[model samples]
Target: MALAYFNGNIVDMDDPVIPIEERGHQFGDGVYEVIRFYQGKPFMMREHLERLYTSAKAIRLEIGKQQNELETLMLELAAKSGLENADLYMQATRGVAPRNHLFPKCPASISITVKPSRELPQDVRKQGVQVVLLPDERWQNCYIKSLNLLPNILAKQEAFEQGCFEAVLVRDGFIMEGSSTNMFIVKDGKVQTTPLSNYILAGITRLAVKRIAEELQVPFVEKPFTPEELLQADEVFLTSTTSEVLAVTSADGRQIGSGCPGPVTRKLYEHFQLKVK
Candidate 1:
């Protein structure tokens, strides 16, 4: 049975004690972080937790415990759940409130769950997946990993309806990123991605990719590129916590780079695997 950390206590998954008035439920006032674990050890845990702290501060939600305590609890929870490889998700909400938008006087509530890790479909990783472009319709503070995700959810649903795996959000014809992942493109043997900004999430995997690119000596540029540029690029990819690196083969039913994962993508994919090992 999976164990969860709730309000400083480890509890069974079936517990129903979370108050209905919890601010997270009533107003979506919370922040979260997803950390990947390998062999019972969380990969890049420090980085994830750092971002979690930043997110919480952005929303003025204070965690009751220190960073070290949270890290210890996370490892303990993973061990107690007997998870060797998984995703550890932790969230903090502004606590229960009286159904009002006003700030509550209570302390924040912390919840953590560890679930079995899921790998991306092998075919999609190898053959690449399709994506559709949508206008960026999200709030300006997207850099914070908050719980208000309705816009992102709707965009993802739209992508699914269009028979695509993801949506690349465009603002003023410039491709910002996918609804839930960082976007990258390769042109003329050079790699490019949007600079970290309020328009997109500064993904941990995206930073890792930059390191990999530098080590591999691949030319990289952190400049904005347009959707049309992506459509004509020799290779396109997306990065996230779950999806280390994925190629984009088609956009709006149009073929991309011979309609297959390009060589540069394969090289990066291989390097990504080695880094995770």
Candidate 2:
């Protein structure tokens, strides 16, 4: 069985009992980060933690543990789990309390679970995948990685039922992002994606991809593009902590460009591999 760290205690996943009264359970009052590791070294761990703390602060939730302490504990959990290639899912929730809809005096409750990493399907990487357009029905504070994910969950379910890789969310006719990943499109050899705003999560992989684009001398732009623009783009893709860089060959069953992973997407994917290696 995998190992889990709950409130500073490491235990088997099957036995890490969480109390029913935890505020996160009742009200989704929490923030989380998922750290991916390669060859036992976490990739961009500091960036992920920084975002996690930022999310917590935005929600007015106090993460009592210092950054150093959290880092040491995460490394220890990784070592104890003996997972060379894994994903560390960490979450901090407001403490247990009666259902009051208000902050309580209880300390924050932290949990971390270690699981083996699952690579994106090779077929999708090589041939690219299809996505569906969905309405962006999330809250205004998506920039904060809070645990209120009902909207995201519903969108993901819609995508799964449609046999698509992701749901590209649209708001006010402009493409915002995916349910679980960030979206990018290439038009006339220029790369464009939604800018960093409350509309989308500022993804770490998105930053890494931008750097790779710069290193490769690929033209990069960050601005809002409509759903029609996205559909007509020469190429499209999504990025996330787990998915890394993925090409979208089609949306709503319509082919994109030549119906394959475009040159810019391939180039970024290659450079991303080199970066992580």
Candidate 3:
């Protein structure tokens, strides 16, 4: 039996009931954060919370709670879950409202749920995983971690049907990011990724990878790279809260470099693991 925080009350995970007219359900009007815990301690928690607030602000959706209060509630829920490794998922929506395109005047409703953590398959880390390229058809505010994600869902499903682990999204021929992760490329011993922009989500793991690269003396450059360049790179990888650092061995049936997780990716993953610990 796990615990959940809903509308300022702690309740059984399976007991809390969300109203049918909740705006998050009726209109996808919300922002969310997924924080990972290692050894029962949250990693980059401040960063995640900051991003959560940023997303909420971007949507003009108030979280209705102070940052400290939210953090305390999340940690309490994590302790109640009793999972050494788990994910803290919190979402703030515009509250229950009648269906309308206009913004609601009600205060936001917040919910926090804790669940078991997910680790990338050992085979993926050992042999790398395949990805396919898809056109970026999402809305302009990709930076917001809003509940609206139809395009991302469709693209990820398409990639799954094509036997790929993830979908590398392209905008005007340049690779922006993965469906649920940030894309990276290594060429000529230099690592490159898209810069922080409205085109993609600024993933927390992506920031950690950059910091690890800096500490390890890896040349980490932030710039846009085309889909052609991504396919031709010596190595490719993706980063996300759940995926961590994942190597992309092939794209669209084409082998990248030696068709394996290259040395650079391996080194980054190693350092990232140590950082999390």
CA lDDT scores, all candidates in order: 0.89, 0.92, 0.91
Q: In candidate 1, which residue ranges exceed 4 Å CA deviation?
A: none
Candidate 2 is scored at a TM of 0.98
lDDT of 1 by residue, 107-215 (tens): 8999998888888879878889999999999999999999999999999999999999999899877989899999999999999999988888889998888988999
Task: In angstroms, give how far residue 233 of model 2 lies from its true place.
Answer: 0.9
For candidate 3, the per-residue lDDT at 92 reads 97
**Is 1 or 2 the stronger prediction by lDDT?**
2
Cα lDDT over the full model 3 = 0.91
lDDT comparing candidate 2 with the true structure: 0.92
lDDT tens readout by residue for model 3, 1-277: 3567789888777784888899999989999999999989999999999999999999998888899988888888898889989988899999988888899888899988888898877987999999999999999889999999999999999999999999999998788999999999999999999999998999999999998999888999999999889989999999999989989999999999999899999999988889878
Q: What is the lDDT of residue 264 in candidate 1?
A: 82
* Deviation from native of the Cα of residue 183 in model 3, angstroms: 0.2
Candidate 3 TM-score over all chains jointly: 0.97
